[model samples]
Target: MTSLAEATGHALDLLLAGDAGLWQIIAISFKVSGSAILLATPPALLTAFVLAYLRFPGRRLLISLFSTLLSVPAVVVGLTLYLLLSNQGPLGDWRLLFTQSAMVMGQVVLAFPILVAMGHAALQSVDKRAWETARTLGASLLRAFFMVLREARFGLLAALLAAYGRIIAEVGASMMLGGNILDYTRNIPTAIALETSKGEFAQGIALGAILLLLAFTLNGILQHVQGKGVPST
Candidate 1:
């Protein structure tokens, strides 16, 4: 109990002191994950819109594929990317392994399906007449699409928040692709893993606290949005 108390105190000190290492890890985490989700949003949302609005053969199969990918383990993604980026791999010439870019790529893979699946759900839940109403008003195709998006904004925001939560908390892909390089590709999850391995309880606890805070804050806002009458599910 005494040791636990000491560790907690030390962890608080690390946070309160604004320890550079801790902050750097946090910053890199947000940087990579944020960029990844931002890059993925457009295509994912477009794909969702298409899937939700268009009728086509094999569409259900494709939707199922995206849903299945949502549960794929992070290490599996990391391993696949590792091979693709390795020296003998086809894309090896670009030499992107063990870098922040690689980490971001892994996160993109992680977040894409989530955004697509949830976005599709959001768009599909909207009243079909919304699209028709916009088009009947002689709105251009682009404007009609924007109208549908506006109607689904709350649910869309929920989807994005969920995606951000997943990528931010993931450890396997980040550790494998980022290489946990200090002052470089290291991120919150990877840094926490490293610190715990080294028996640095204070640093690990500090990082964990930050993660908990982020998770709580995100979930709080999510609940608030849902309470404010977003789409159910």
Candidate 2:
């Protein structure tokens, strides 16, 4: 217990002293996950919208496939991407392995299915009349689509938060794809893993503190969004 308390104190000191390496790790985490989520969101949302609203052959199969992907292990994604980006791989000429971009790619694979599945559920729960009402008002198909999205905004936001949470917390994909290189591709999760392994508990605890704070902030925003979404009594 004394050792734990001392470690916690050291963690606080690290944060208070503004450790540059720690902050750099945090920044890399956000940069990679942010880029992955941003790049994946539009297409994921579009696919969700289609699955929720459109009728087509094998659509159910596609939805099932995406839903299955939601549970895939992070290391599996990293391995598959690693293979594709390795020197002998077909697309290896781009030389993206063991880089931040590779980490982003792995995260994109992880987040895309999550966004699609959650976004589909959200869009499906929304009233069908939203699209119809917009069309009744002579809104273009694009405008009607926007109307549906507006109605599903809260749920979509929830999906976004969930995706961010997953990617930010994931370690295997980032570690394998980014190689956990110092001052470059190192991120919070991988850094925590490395630091803890080296008996450097303070930095790991500090990074964990930041992650906890971020989780709290996201939950707060989710609650606020939910409150605003609810109809007044």
Candidate 1: regions farther than 4 A off? 230-233
Best by lDDT: 2
- Residue by residue across 69-92, what tens digits does model 2's lDDT show? 999999999989998999988879
Q: Superposing every Cα of model 2 onto the true structure, what RMSD results?
A: 1.8
lDDT of 1 by residue, 1-233 (tens): 23878988999999999999889988999999999999999999999999999999999999999999999999999999998998898878988898999999999999999999999999999899999999999999999998999889888998999899999989999888889999899999998888788777898889899889998998898888778875433
The RMSD of every model to the true structure, in order and in angstroms, is 2.0, 1.8
- Residue pairs of candidate 2 with colliding backbone atoms: none
Stretches of candidate 2 exceeding 4 Å from the true structure: 231-233
Instruction: Tell how far residue 68 is off in model 1, in angstroms.
Output: 0.5
**Candidate 2 clash figure, as a count:** 0
For model 1 the local lDDT of residue 211 reads 86
Query: What are the lDDT scores of the predictions, listed in order?
Result: 0.91, 0.94
